[model samples]
Target: MRMRLLVVGLLVAFMALTGCAKNQMSTEPGTQAGENAAVATDSQNSNGLSEQDLADQQRQAMAAAEQEITQNRIYFGFDKFDLDAEAKDVLKTKAEALKAHSEWKMLIEGHCDNRGTEEYNLALGERRARAAYEFLVMLGVPSSNLKIVSFGEERPAVDADNEAAWAKNRRDEFKLFK
Candidate 1:
């Protein structure tokens, strides 16, 4: 009986506090129901995030993940599709990001230098993209979240006829879905 009364008293106190806050929340000129709900939740949730707060955090997280995945292009050797140590490290980071954010979907775009025939370059590009895709899958990213496309030598990061340009071109790139 004593415990029951204590519980009831606590409930009353909570209701009083919530009521006061919720009322103050509605005093604004154009307060909506959702905004009020968010305000109420802010006072209760441990995360201390209202609806907008959570949304903003999620957007920021995705942007960070997108930057991690896209900024470091995975370059391959001449006529090679195998991953080097640097590429593997980058993919490991990417896999961690993808694992943390399963809601994110991405496209792995394969590219090549303008040395091989169009057909060969296309196939090589596909192979390069597949290599990255397989590595990510091995590191525990869901295959369903990833898709691959081969641009072959059509999209060059540095459009010049030099070893440096070719090295940049012989790479795999990443794109995050909107």
Candidate 2:
């Protein structure tokens, strides 16, 4: 009777090991069972979004937001922090975009031409960035969603010492954050 019990136990162990091995070996890619497993994993979770689906949506949203920020910039006048008509128009468009996508946060960088002293340029840049920030807030963009930074004359948009280069350097740039 003891011998029969030992034999039955061995048989059960062998069957269990074989079943596990079969499952592991059958999970290779390109197999129909593997494809089905992937589909099962993509089914809606408790949050109603599959892991893969949610990741794709996040990637697309980030790309669109980055593009929007990159496409819009406001230029400043020589040694001036005021927003001209053209700058106001650009800000209006940017404000509308920001309103539509409330999840985005931005950094407004103030820059200056290489004409002023370092200390003076830094102050000017700060004022320029602050002007942009205030204008955006007035246009209905939440002040909490924006930050201001002054690069001064350290980073020039164009390195040439010509008027065109100076014009490009005196600008406010927009950058996106989480």
Candidate 3:
């Protein structure tokens, strides 16, 4: 009886291993059936993305945007649109990059940390985006190649209730236009 049971278990394990190996080989290109199988398997599995996978996806996305026009949003301290020395330095570099590529268009998205009333935050965000736009114009970026939008406090980079997150949430984002 023991020998019979051991034999059965070994057969079951072998079958499982064989199935996995077949699936692995199916993912290789040049095999239409395998490709279809792999796609079916991936579709069936809705697991969350891994960190490394997420990073790889982000890299691919940036590469795809390489030829498109890009925009950068300049962040600011609460209640102020004045560019500090560091912010000014960042803007200068951005200006040079944009001027070098005249065909690229950009949209500056202004955002604020979640600390103020919605209406107030929206105004602040608009001010921040406008400040960057003006600086870019002064730096020789064409007005026709730039646009602006303010998201206010509704969109926070970090949702945690902490100063560190707030600081990160208050930022300007750059979107690329194809």
Candidate 4:
């Protein structure tokens, strides 16, 4: 009786595994009933994005990610909120991208190095963030799509006391929201 029960259990397990395999195989592209089953002909998929529209969105997202990784910051001089020529150029490119994607919104965060009093750094960070925000607005990016905040000296990009670390910490960072 034990032998018979063991055989039955093995058979049930085998059947269960085969059932799962069959379900997986049926969903594969070539295993569908018709060759055209893999093709999406509707202008809009169930998610409401057409194939072209989905592709476009993917490209935009990739571009935005690359920009954020490489150039989404405008560095500032110590105790200064003014945009240098290079900072202005960076903002121009960012503004153009913002214009291209009207559905996207941006948060500009102002940060400062750990050289000043907490209260003073906080106020200076706000000024730096506001400068970037105003520059983007002047470059034709919609004012409604931009928001600003100040981190002051609380969140340092680098913790060292050297000039290089201080320079890295004093900047405005851009974050994207949809």
Q: Which candidate's TM-score is highest?
A: 1
Query: Which scores greater on lDDT, model 1 or model 2?
Result: 1
Number of colliding residue pairs in model 4? 0
lDDT tens string, model 4, 50-79?
A: 788899999988787548534668999989
All candidates in order of lDDT, best leading: 1, 2, 4, 3
TM-score of candidate 1 on Cα atoms, chains taken together: 0.70
Runs off by more than 4 Å, candidate 2: 1-65
Off by over 4 Å in 1: 1-55
lDDT of 2 at 159: 97
Q: For candidate 2, lDDT tens digit of each residue in 1-178?
A: 9999999999999988777654673557899888878777766365678777789998897677677676777898888999999899988877887887899898999999999899999999999999999999999999999999999999998999999999999999998888
- Give candidates' CA RMSD values in order: 7.4, 10.0, 18.7, 14.2
Q: What digit string (tens of lDDT, one per residue) describes model 1 on residues 20-39?
A: 65355344535686677766
lDDT of 4 at 135: 91
Candidate 2 pairs with clashing backbones = none
Q: Model 2 — which ten-residue stretch has the worst lDDT?
A: 19-28
Task: Count backbone clashes in candidate 2.
Answer: 0
- Can you tell me which runs of candidate 4 are displaced by over 4 Å? 1-71
Candidate 1 lDDT score at position 32: 84
